[model samples]
Target: MVYDLNISAGELRASAGAADTLVTDLRPVLKKAVDDLTAASSSLRHWTAGPRMAETGEGWGGALGALRDNLTEHARGLRLLANGRDIMEQEVLSSFKGW
Candidate 1:
């Protein structure tokens, strides 16, 4: 059985653009939150206040930081995919351009 994904390159481009814009808008706020989390984690560690609690804070901070990084990577991938679609479409339509 052959299956078509029913995906549209134009839609991909639009979605990617929207994602990029949203991420750009949220960057500063997210960064500040991550920074605050890390700082709190560091403070907890310095005070030697309950090893488990400090560790948990550090873990949460790390996870949040990783999440931010993943979002960046996802955005990059989306743009790349969108651009790839455009390139492929251009190549496919090249023959008709002269007419």
Candidate 2:
């Protein structure tokens, strides 16, 4: 899963004084949030909304709960990513002086 985020690593690494700090600060939170979302999405896959859905009734409820948790975490993760992006945009991609 972490491998998939490689596309944005340049942006994430741009501001860090040391490469490890970037991983330290960002990886844990991002990992958990993504994992939660994945679990939620996976749970939802087994849900059947119509009658005779009993075959997966527990999964349906679990899916909803997982989705709820994922939604909440997703919002927070987005904010962190935005803040990190802003840091990269301002510190790494800019001269920190006006044009």
Candidate 3:
């Protein structure tokens, strides 16, 4: 394989930037999901749960759905980061002479 160090370096840098961007975007979403889950869990834990059962159930369901979606997004973001890291790593290894 023909390995051009200059192009590989640029690509690796770009991919690393993309990974950082993905992490930046994912963190807030994960945090919001955690916040929603915490709030829902707290409401359940502190319940006079019977009186507000229907309302609380509905709210909890919505929060859980939001959390689920956020988790999905996090998974996707993680995959992206993994792919970027893999590319960067391959570029690095390819640039080296003997490995």
On lDDT, the leading prediction is 1
TM-score of each: 0.59, 0.36, 0.42
Which regions of candidate 3 deviate over 4 angstroms? 1-51
- Cα deviation of 45, candidate 2, in Å: 27
Native-vs-model 3 lDDT?
0.62
Name model 1 segments beyond 4 Å from true.
Answer: 1-4, 21-49, 95-99
User: Model 1, 1-99: lDDT tens per residue?
Assistant: 999876776777677677677767777876676567566766677566645555665676677667667777777787788788788889989968988
lDDT (C-alpha, whole model) for all candidates: 0.71, 0.54, 0.62
Worst 10 residues of 3 by lDDT: 4-13
Question: Would you list the rank order by TM-score, best first?
Answer: 1, 3, 2
- Taking the tens digit of each residue's C-alpha lDDT, what string does model 3 give over 8-97? 444545665665576667667756765665666566766665336546555766765675566556656656666777788889988995
By summed lDDT, the worst window of 10 consecutive residues in model 1 runs over: 46-55
What digit string (tens of lDDT, one per residue) describes model 2 on residues 1-99?
A: 345554363453343324344445555665565555556656665554332343344455566556555555555565577577777877855775666
Top candidate on TM-score is 1
**Comparing 1 and 2 on lDDT, the stronger one:** 1
Q: After superposition, how far is residue 31 of candidate 2 from its true place, in Å?
A: 28
